[model samples]
Target: MKFSQWIGFTILAFCVYILWNIRQLLLLLFTAAIIANFLNHGVQLLQRIGMKRGSAVLSSILLSLIVLSGFFLIIIPPFAEQLPELFKLVSLGLDQLILTIKDFILRLDPELIKALPNSQQVVEQLEPLIQIIAGQGLSVFYTTLGIPLTLLLLFALTLMLLVNPSAYRQGFIRLFPSFYRKKIDHILTECDRSLQGKLTRILFKMVMITMLSFIGLSLLGMRLTLAQSMLAGILTFIPNIGPVLSLIPPVAIALLENPWKSLSVFVLYIIFYLVISIIESKFVAPLLIENRKSILPAVTLLAQVFFGISFGVLGFFLALPLALVAQVWLKEVLVKDILDQWKSNYNYSHQEFTSELKKK
Candidate 1:
């Protein structure tokens, strides 16, 4: 193709290379920005209640810390204690499940059962996989020790952003061409509004859903209902895969206690998830994102996975907003102005051709 196109492609590739090299830093910055955006809402509310900006920020930070600490206190120890045992139990459960499957298959289809790998062999193969996951889990635990440092950085950045949001907005807008800056500004404002509303609704709904899940699981006599419920609720933020992963722990716990009881709990979880998901899709999402277009669910999920893979847990958490930002940029800037221009010109030419034919 054209030399200009080649140059553009090269530039794009170079930029991507640079981004990949500095992905960790970019992830940290994005994480800070997301936290700042959420906390900015609290700072604004506190300001409305007659607090100064600094005081509001400080209060919001402290409150966040308290909530986080309380959550850790309630959830972490039991999780730490039970998680290892849960893994061991799950391995045993899988072995038993495989054996049951093999027995049933042998009765129904002897050839098929013979073709399958032995249950004991399968279990042996899984041992290495389990060890790798356990190692990763330990890594995660150690990584968590850096959380206070991360939070401090986030708080400092957030305070700066809240103290003078306009400055940051203007700085970002200036990165674009002068002709596009105004449009970019509008897009940023719209994104901020959309995210604020969506996140608030999500947080509130998650809390209610978690509470209901906890109560339901508790009623069903599931162990660690509170912890599992909290996990299930938090995972809901990740979209499609989250609920499934969340259900696994409780279902396994139920199975360990009693097979029939686990089956009941599993069925209950499926029903509950279906109902809640329907309600969320039909009512909650629409209400939260009223008048604000969002990226497709598939795109959102892909972005989360991509970011999560590249940058780990923090990346996963910030993926949605980052994807939203990318979507807004594509739609408002690239699609509307650049791509639509070609379509508009083509339509105009077609109209002219039709007029000439009519005259002829």
Candidate 2:
């Protein structure tokens, strides 16, 4: 309407355009922030036990490094060695499965036998899509192309943020007006808490899934059970979809080991999934997170699409947590404060004017 208003709009649009252009860097920063937050909790814990801040931070970093080292060392080497055999077993399993299906169809109806899709053709069609999805997911953590550099930067940024979080927190608060600084600080705290709770929930699922899968797979006499279970646990980070994918390799191996055992392995996974889901829903979630505002499956899928598009593979992996953080901020700052207050403020003003008129 006014020149100042037009100028303000232009500036705001320009800022958004700038932000869009640098989104990748922003995402990397966000990833760093999430890592920092996770580490910060460890730092806080150490501090509570009389450790100094610097030592706590360094200890947290080293502890993370140790954990990661253990994962790669213990998990990767065995998986790498078994990979070829695993693939062969999987192929055999698929072939056997197809044959079994064909035989079943032939018994039920001769016509249905001719209609059965060729497994080779289906695999060929799916191969490229699977490669792309897997590649992208892998890129989130490491790509041979960017391996050390990207990860180095990520860790470096995380350490910097973790080292002096209050400075960054205050810097962010200072962006707002003096009067609103306190409110912004409060909102940031809420986001921190929300993110921490989400991280805790995911970690719980990972540990439980890993332990259960190991025990169940071992009982089934599967090869490489520990590595497979570890993979399953890590895959739990991907939410509903990941655990399902994790089942494929083991199920195929089970089938190759013993066709009958395939069914047993499958049943075990289902039972464990049900058990884990119930515990999370009934106890872990409630204890960790105050607001159990469910993340709908549809919304989760949409988050994958949006983040995957915006940030690529890395975005896809971080989508759930990013969505969670965004949800908290939007609810607290936008919906609760801005949108919800509008009508109430309007009603209050109207009532005040009415009172003045009656007094007059």
Candidate 3:
């Protein structure tokens, strides 16, 4: 390789090393960027209505605050009321289930019934694990409380970006070689368009699914339908595992009400989710994405699990978008340039071989 090419490769390698080392910071910044983009869209809409940019940004921020407050107001009370009751019911039902299992065991083999551990003793043995699980749950709740702070920082950064997006654009453009800057800019624009389109459509679909789930569960007389449905919809972004998580609350409640009812509710939930997911995977997502490429759903979900484990709840929420960004970078920069070069080299050697064969 030429001296300049070697130097460029070294610099790129160094940058990659730095990025790997500071991935947490990068994640936070990426999340901020997404929030900024959403805020910018809202501000732009207000601007189209003849509002001044400053006024538009301020109004957008205020509107966001109102929406968030309203969401919390709607969600919290029902959750608080249902959680304790749900836990009590779960404990009682578990005890009853154990008794039923023991009775069946006695009927099948009298000796096996004597071998079974007392239910209370088993529960005592499991207490530490249960406490650990509850601790993790509380940590999630604490992380959620940080959302307001995150939003504040995001809004402040967004206002600055909205006020002068060109400054950041120019800075980013300057990071590339002069020959590639314009191409990079165009790629960035395409990415923004793709991300924005997909995000909006996906959010809308999730909301629709949530509402439908709520209505169905309510009609079925399930407890905490609203909260459960809302949670299910929100977690839908997590792909394969999301619907399963959503099913737990309703199924647990049903089990508490009656084992047979729980089995029926489980079947109904499975059917409902199957139909919804099929429509989403086959039609909705494809239409929204249109001919645009995206990361594999499996890769996206795996990334979510990895990030959620490492960084907790914030990571979970940001995982899919981060995966999407990584996919775009890999496709545009790595595959297009590096892999295409390798392909060209292969083609050249093949053509030379064919020419030599003809001469032979």
- Among all candidates shown, the one with the greatest TM-score: 2
lDDT of 1 by residue, 1-360 (tens): 799999999998999999987666566666667678888888888999999988997898889889989978987788677667666766676656666677899889889976787867887997774555444333433554365766567667766776777789899999888998889888887778767766776676577668878888889877666667777788877766777777777766676667787788778877876777688777777665332675688988789767666666656766777777777778777898888775447788999999999999
Name the top lDDT candidate. 2
Q: Give the TM-score of candidate 2.
A: 0.82
Between 2 and 3, whose TM-score is larger? 2
Local distance difference test, each candidate: 0.74, 0.82, 0.72
Order the candidate numbers by TM-score, best to worst: 2, 1, 3
Instruction: Give the Cα-based TM-score of candidate 3 against the true structure.
Output: 0.71
Off-target runs (Cα >4 Å) in candidate 2 are: 102-145, 278-290, 342-360
Please count the clashing residue pairs in each candidate, in the order shown.
0, 0, 0
Please give the TM-score that candidate 1 achieves against the real structure.
0.76
- Over 1-360, each residue of candidate 3 has an lDDT whose tens digit, in order, gives 999999999999999999866655555667667777767877888889899988987788788889988877987688667767766665665666666678789889999877778967888997775555444434533554365665566556666776676688789899889999987887677667667766775686578668877888888888767667777787776656666776666666676778888788778877776776687777677555332676677897788766665555566766767667667777778888787666447788999999999999
